[model samples]
Target: MNIHEYQAQKILKTFGIKVPYSILASNLEETVYAAKKVFKKTKNYICVIKAQIHAGGRGKGGGIKIAKSIDDVYKKSSNILGRRLVTNQTNKKGKLVNKVIISEYVLNSDKEYYVSIFYDRNIYKNIILYSKEGGLEIEDISKKIYFQKIDPYIGLQEFQIRKIAFHLKMKYSAFNNFIKKLYNAYIYSDASLFEINPFLITNDNEILAIDAKVRLDDNAFFRNLSYKEMSDEREYSIIELEAKKAGLNFLKLDGNVACMVNGAGLAMATMDMIKIYGANPANFLDLGGKADSKRIKKGLDLILKDKKVKLILINIFGGIVRCDIVAEGIIKFFEKKNKINLPIIIRLEGTNVNIAKKILNNSKLHYYYVTSLEEAANKIKVLLKNELRCFI
Candidate 1:
């Protein structure tokens, strides 16, 4: 699960990672108080009052505002609160700003740095990432981070820390402390990935982790009460929450076609084929490798809920997930709903394919089943064309 910047800093502080002084505020009164507290520390301070939301690209979307005074802070916070913060990285509705983090910003820095740890499913290892170039325009920066193997059994080592520190060009004096602090933060947080972008070395040449982005393993949520407490009400869509409850990996996108696949790799391939077929997909819904009848129905329900979905495609290349199970699930879904007019095309292969086809046929529901991938795409295209013509 993702967390706010203030909470992330608290985690960092717990691990002895030095961060800028900050305070969390929810309303206008708290924002003014936070500003007063920071102002008391130093006048003419470069202050920043940022909207605390789970989404990114805040600066580009005016969610991160600079405040030169308490008045500026109040004004900025008022504008941000009660309004939706729409970033390039967020959905159209955007995340709500129930809280804001007020901080004393760093004055001057020529360069920035970033360190992150992400789980590489392909490699089956928790990978460490560090880059010298980090900050607001970080995406533009050349990705030259160090990657070290994380042995969950043993945890972080001096070797891995040194590798990241040396690569980041950290000062000789502060290298050891920085590495130790960052490593500790990574382990203690129970985080799948920890990111500190623009981990700054100040004008006086003091190291500080200016920005923190920690991605905790969702499975490990029960272990970390602190992370759980950081959950915000305005994180995701109702559909997203429902999808999670229904045990489906559903990501909403911009298009007319909604897709469902049985595996991660196959989901990606289905999306690619949809694009190749000149139709954009509205979502990426993975029903997983299991052929649980209930899950299949839930997946279908999630996709069909979208009014933009002109065509729904179910592409299942069954391995452990049997085609018959999927067909049975589909039949059950249709029976319960009584009727659905959405154009659906199914491409089922692998285990018990014939049995699946027979089950679908027995249901007497109108659906196109093609043996080849190309045939499935052609059928979807034709369906889309027919749908558009009917609408026109």
Candidate 2:
């Protein structure tokens, strides 16, 4: 989950990482109060007011502003608060900026650095990325010559740390201390990504994390409250929560065809195929393995409630979920709902396949059953085309 810089900084503090003191404000008055409260000693102290949104590129979006004076701080916060900040990652309408985090800004030269640790599921390793050139062009700099390694079980070992430090041309004494501390922080926080863009070097030649951005793994939420609290209300819609509560994974998309699949990979491929067939998928719904009749019923109910859903598609490549079990689930859902009017296309290929066809054929619901994925897509396209014509 993406969090505000303030929240990420708080996590850093817990790991003994030095960070600036800050306060959060959601309004103009609060912004002024925060500016007054946080930066008391230094009149000419540099301050940054950043919009507390889930997405990134805040600087480019005008969500991040630097103020030279208290009045400037208040002015910048006023302009940012209650405004819609658009980033490359945000939707066209942009995300609403309701809160701003004001913090003391640090000063350093442009010769910054970048470091990050990520879990690559495919390689099944903890990968650490580092670059001497930090800030805006870090990614571009990475392409030139950077360092990355994949360790099976352990994270950045001492030798690996030394290698990165040496490769980045960091001073031996400082790099050793920085590498050890940073590596420990990466492990302790269970972060998927820990990045310090422009990991600054002060005039005293001391390394400081001027800007922090960390993304923790959601699967680790049971242990990480800091990441959980950073969640934004606008990030999840009502339909999404409903699906989650029902033990289904759902992502709402701009499409008319609603999909219900058994696995994540299957769901993604289904969405891709639907798009290829000139049909849009309204949702990515994964019922998961071992889903029973009740769960299936819940999934169907959730999809049917979406007014934009003109066609429903159930594609299950069952292994743990037998075809008969799925058939029973669909039957139970229709019975409970007392009616089924939407055009549904079903494609089941796995255990008890013939039995599933038998059960579906006996049902009174208006639906089509296809063995081939292409046939299902074609049928859904035709159904949606008819729906458009009827609407017109």
Query: TM-score for each prediction?
Result: 0.85, 0.85
TM accuracy, model 2: 0.85
Quantify all predictions' global Cα lDDT against the true fold. 0.80, 0.78
Task: Kindly list the per-residue Cα lDDT of model 2 for residues 252-283, writing each as its tens digit.
Answer: 77788889999999998899889999999999
Cα-based lDDT at residue 121, candidate 1: 79
lDDT of 1 by residue, 92-189 (tens): 98878888888987776777777777677776777777788887787776556556778766777777667777787776567677766776777767
Best by TM-score: 1
Among all windows of ten consecutive residues in candidate 1, which has the lowest summed lDDT?
A: 383-392
